[model samples]
Target: MSFDYEKYIRPGKLPHIWCPGCGHGIVMKGLIRAMDALGMKKNNTAIVSGIGCASRLPGYIDCCTLHTTHGRAVAFATGIKMAKPEMQVLCVGGDGDGVAIGGNHFIHACRRNINITYLIMNNNIYGMTGGQFSPTTPTGAKASTTPYGNPDPPFDIAKLAIGAGATFVARGTAYHANQIEKLLVEAIRHKGFSVVEILDSCPTTYGRRNRFRSVVEMMNNLKEIAVSVQAAEHMSPEQMQGKVLTGVLYRDNRPEYVEEYQKVIEAAQDFAG
Candidate 1:
C-alpha cells in the first residue's frame, strides 16, 4: 500500500509556502515516514524548528511542535528534551538557523551529548529573509547579498558536528529520498546527541543566483556529488576530493546529558538526607 502521509500531517496545513522546485517538502515527508517506521505517536513526539524556510516543517506535522525565533530551535529543543527525556525530540532548521546564529547552541548540545535529534537542511543559501549568504554557502558562490561572489568559507556540517562531539552524525541529500528516512530512523534511535545534515535544494534563491539552469540541475548536482560512506572507503582521496560522503558518518558511546543530570538531582537529595 502507498504510504498514508495525510495521517501524520496537520489538518488544513496543506499547500506549504515553499517555492516551486523546493526540496523542503521532500524532507518533511521523509521525517513523517521515519516517525511511522518507529511507531512514534504524535503525543510522544515533539518537533521543533526556528525561523526559516526549512523551519516551517514542524508547523505542518501533527505533533507537539515548537516554532521559535531565528536560530533558537536547538536551544528550545534542548530544554524540551531535558524536561521530557522520554519524548522523541527533533530539532529541524535550515543551515543558517542551525550553524550561523545558533552555532553555539548546536555545538554545546553536542558536547553535552543531549539525547535529541537535529536535522539540518543545508540548501547552501538562506532562502528566507531575502536570500542572503549563509555559513554553508560555498566560497565563490553568489547570493543576493553577494552579487559578485561570496568570500566566506562554507562549513561542512557533518564534520563540524563530529568535531563538536555529537555522538551520532550522518548525512543524506534531497536526491536520495529513499535514504533520508533510513538515516533519520537511525539518528533518532541513537542514545546521545544526533545530527542529520540533509543537503537539500533551494532552487528559487540559490539556483537563480548561482546560475543553475533549473531545479533538476541542482538535484542532479546533488546526485553526482554524493558518494556513499561504504563506497568512499575504496576510492582514493583524489577521487573523493569533490564528493560528499553520505550515510551514517560517525557514532560514539557517550553518557547522555539528561541521564547524567538525574544523578546530580539524586546527589542533592541524598545530601539533604
Candidate 2:
C-alpha cells in the first residue's frame, strides 16, 4: 500500500535545506512511515531536535515539533515526557548534537529509562557546522577540524546507549530504508528509553572529504558493511571488523522512569493518609 507522506509533512516547509544526495531525507521518510503505520496522531506526538543538519527534520514535520538549541534536544524532550507522560515524544539529533555536547544529557536519559524514543543520525561528521569531526566520526577520518585525520576514536552510539542503561537499542542504515522504518516502529513502541542509531550519509561534507565519488557510492558502502545481528553472531571478530550490525542490539523491560516516579508519589500520599 502506498502511503501519502504529504499528510505528515508541513506543506509550506517544502524545499528542505538538506543538500542533494544527503541521506537525512531517507531517514526522515522512514520515521514518517513508521509513525503512519502505528497510526500515531500528530497532536499526540511531539518531535524534538537539536542544532545540526539532521535537527532540521522537525521543521519539516507537521507534528508538534521543537527545534531546540544545540545539544539540548534531549533535555527538552525529557521535560516534555515528564510533564505529559501520555504524549509520544521523539527526539531527533545528529552525531554531534546527541553525543558531543549533549553527551551528558543523552546518557542520563538512558540511565533513567525515560519513556521516549531518540533517533541519532550518525553521519560521522558535523555537516551543518562546517564539516567538523564529531564524536561518532571514525578515527583517522579527515574532517574540517582534522585536516590530516581525526586522532580520537569514535563512539559507537548503540554501545553507548546500551551501556548507559537504555531499555531498547537498535541500529539501521539509510540504504536499508525498510529496516529503518521497522526499527523506528519498534523503538517508538518500547516503553522505556529507546535509541535508534541511523548510519546516514553526508555526501556534500563527509563524503567529499572521505573520497566518496558520489552519494550512491557512500550508500553502497553502508550496504556492504551492514550485517544483521544474527549473521554477526556467526562471524569471527576479524570478520566483524568495520562492519555495522543492524537490528535490535539490546532490549530489556525495565521500569520506565515516569511510571516509577508516579508510584513514589502515590506511596508518599498513602503513607500520609
Candidate 3:
C-alpha cells in the first residue's frame, strides 16, 4: 500500500523554524512514515507537544494537534488518553521539556503505563531557549549556560524510561533514518507506554558553542560514540565512560493502566450485583 504525506501535512507550514542543520526534520519524516505504514487515521490520532522547537511537530501534522504549555505535554496527553483510549495519542518534545521541567511527569507516565507513545528529541541542549544545558546534556558538554564546561552528568533517557516502568523503550538517531521509522511503528503499536529517544542536532546552539563546526560533524561524532547493548556489555569502564546506547534497549508485556482501570470497573459492577 502507498501513502501520501502531503495529504497529512499542514499547508503553508512548509518552512519549518528549525535551523538549517537541525535534525528535527528527519525525526518528523520518520514519524510520518511510521504513521502512514500503520494506516493510522489522521482524525483518530492526536499529536500533543510541549514548548520547544521539537514541540512544533504538532503544528506541522494535519491531525488533532495540541501545542500545549512548556514541559506539560505528557500530563495533558495523559488526560486525553484516559478519556479516549482509542485515540492514537503521541507526545513530542525536546530534552529540556521531557527530562528537565517535565521529568516528574515523564517518570509517572511511564509508571502508570498509559497507552501513549512519547518521542523525545534529545539534542543535548535547549535549542529553542538559547542553548541552555538540559537533563540529557553530557557532563562536559559546553552550552551557553555552561561557559566553563558542564558539571552535571546527563540522564540516560532510555534507561530512565525502562526503570520507570515504560513497557517499551527505544533509542534512535537522526542519522539512522530507516531504523527510526521502524521503531516508531512498533512503538505506536505497543499496547503500553512507549518511549523513543531520538538523538538530534542543534546546529545553532550546541553546534556553535561546543565547537562542532557543523551539523555533519556532530552527526559523525554521534555515530562514533554510540554503542549497542551487546557492545556495551563487553566494554570496560574507560570505553563506556562517554558512550551512548542506541536501538531497542528494552521492552516487555505489562498490564496497561487504562485496561486495568476498565477491569476494576467491571469488578465493581459484579460486586454490586
Candidate number achieving the greatest lDDT relative to the actual structure: 2
State the displacement of the C-alpha of residue 214, model 2, in Å, after optimal TM-score superposition. Answer: 1.2
Per-residue C-alpha lDDT of model 2 across residues 1-273, encoded as one tens digit per residue: 678999999998978999998889999999999999899999999999999999999999999999999999999999999999989999998999999999999999999999999999999999987799999889999999999999999999999999999999999999999999999999999999999999999998899999999988999999999999999989999999889899999999999999999999999999999
lDDT of each: 0.93, 0.95, 0.91
- Show pairs that collide, candidate 1: none
Candidate achieving higher lDDT, 1 or 3: 1
RMSD of each: 0.8, 0.9, 1.8
lDDT of 1 by residue, 1-273 (tens): 999999899999989999999998989888999999999989999999998999999989999999999998889988898888889899999999999999999999999999999999999888988789999999999999888899999999999999999999999999999899999999999999999999999988899888899999999999999999999989999999889999999999999999999999999999999
Q: TM-score of every model?
A: 0.98, 0.98, 0.95
lDDT comparison, 1 vs 2, better candidate: 2
Return whichever of 2 and 3 wins on TM-score.
Answer: 2
Off by over 4 Å in 1: none
Residue pairs in clash, model 2 = none
> How many angstroms is residue 53 displaced in model 2 relative to the true structure, after the best TM-score fit?
0.8
User: What TM-score would you give candidate 2 relative to the actual structure?
Assistant: 0.98
lDDT of 1: 0.93
For candidate 3, the lDDT comes to 0.91
The sequence of per-residue lDDT tens digits that candidate 3 reaches over residues 1-273 is: 565778779999888888898999999999999998899999999999999999998899999999999999999999999999989999999999998899999999999999999999999999987899998888988998899999999898888999999999999898887888998999999999999999998989998988898788988977887887778888898998867788888889989999999999899999999
Which residue runs does candidate 2 get wrong by more than 4 Å? none
